[model samples]
Target: MNKLLAGKRLLITGAARGLGLDFAQAACAAGAQVVMADILDELVEQEAGALVEQGFDAVAVRLDLADPESIKAVAAFSAARFGEVDGLVNCGAIATGIGGPDMCELEIDTWDRVMTVNVRGTWLMSRAMVPHLAASTAGKIVNIASDTALWGAPRLMAYVASKGAVISMSRSMARELGAQNICVNTVCPGLTLVEATAYVPRERHEHYINGRAIQREQMPEDVTGSVLYLLSDLASFVTGQTLAVNGGFVCN
Candidate 1:
């Protein structure tokens, strides 16, 4: 079969492990040259090197979503490595660990940290990559969000709110970048099982599985097809949409 992303150059943040790692692997498998970036420098380098050994065009860079300079550095590195970036997947985000406190009890610093990395980081990364994306024949941007943002899950106000902002930001970006022939969209996944979510309570896990139309635990692989589609030429005209990859949970 023809690779869906052949000749495409894509960048993914938070790619050291979990969903971000899954995205990198999937993109490479689809024949895209991938830049896998994360705050975990050593781990990301190892992961990217593994991909290269497997005969894929992949590279790793350190990216701290909380720092603007880090975002700019990664953007420059990606452009220099790939010549031009065809797509960007903003998968780097902070989720509530062990579960979050209610909004009234949440610390100001915690809230700010979540917002800074999840919302601001996403915006800044996109800002830095727009010119490069526009240079491609079919530029694409896919922002990773959460189904909880749509359903208003309790005790995780900071995470939910941040992802909500991402959804809104993606739409506005889509409109602004449309003239440049760039497509921007958001993909909201359910409570997926990954290292980042291992701290979540088992009850909550069961709750999600029971609520989903598929009646199974969602995994990183489950979310990749939608992302791949959004980044492919097939989605050239599809923009400003929020696709829920939660097995019918909180359908939108």
Candidate 2:
């Protein structure tokens, strides 16, 4: 295991599967004691157990980003488990099968749900972790966003709008948390091949494959490196930035 994040304690939201799960595993492999939180308690526990069996330090905790109480609880749990947590990766959002609706046709409930979890939840989660993060000498926050927001992908109005809000939110968060040494940034990945994106159309997949500088399907691995960097000490001075991690599908 790499010691890049040795002695650090990190919390990853939406760690049941897909990018969140990948992030949790990667963080553990990087030598960080991780709190893997997600709404799917059993599954997250299983993932954490798998990591522990591999000699990685990790624990599973239930987290519902849409619930303010749940957000508060997770923060407290992390702090209680590992005082002065080193980093937070806000990967929990309502992204699964949330496309195929134009702006005008998108349902208000759908928009609200997306915003509640993606935008508002992120804001609240970051807010809740501020104190614990402040307790650390080096603190970091990485908000997971989507490249679809950058290029204004069609039929994904609510999701795109929600992610755009997250991108904008990270800037403000960085400004506010700068005084305390907490680096806040957003990473926008292109359509990644994950459980959350399995509903994407085949033509759309080919479209992404053809339009990228790398000309390949984006994977969880492709996005994790940037996030891990933002979490590590190497990026201590880097904050309030949006990194487009898509294969140049939407350059930033």
The global C-alpha lDDT for each of the candidates, from Candidate 1 onward, is 0.94, 0.91
- Candidate 1 least-lDDT 10 residues: 94-103
The regions of model 2 sitting more than 4 angstroms off are 96-99
Q: Number of clashes in every candidate structure?
A: 0, 0
Off by over 4 Å in 1: none
Residue-wise lDDT of candidate 1 within 96-194, one digit each (tens)? 754667879999999999999999999999999999998886799999999999999999999999999999999999999999999999999998888
For residues 1-252, what per-residue lDDT tens digits would candidate 2 score against the true structure? 467888889999999999999999888888899999999999999999999999999999999989999999999999999988999999998863544757788789988899999999999999999999999978999999988889988888888889999999999999999999999999998889999888888999999899999998898999888888999999999999999998988778
Model 1 pairs in collision: none
Per-prediction TM-score, please? 0.98, 0.98
For model 2, give the RMSD to the true fold. Answer: 1.0
Decoy 2 TM-score against native: 0.98
Clashing residue pairs for model 2: none
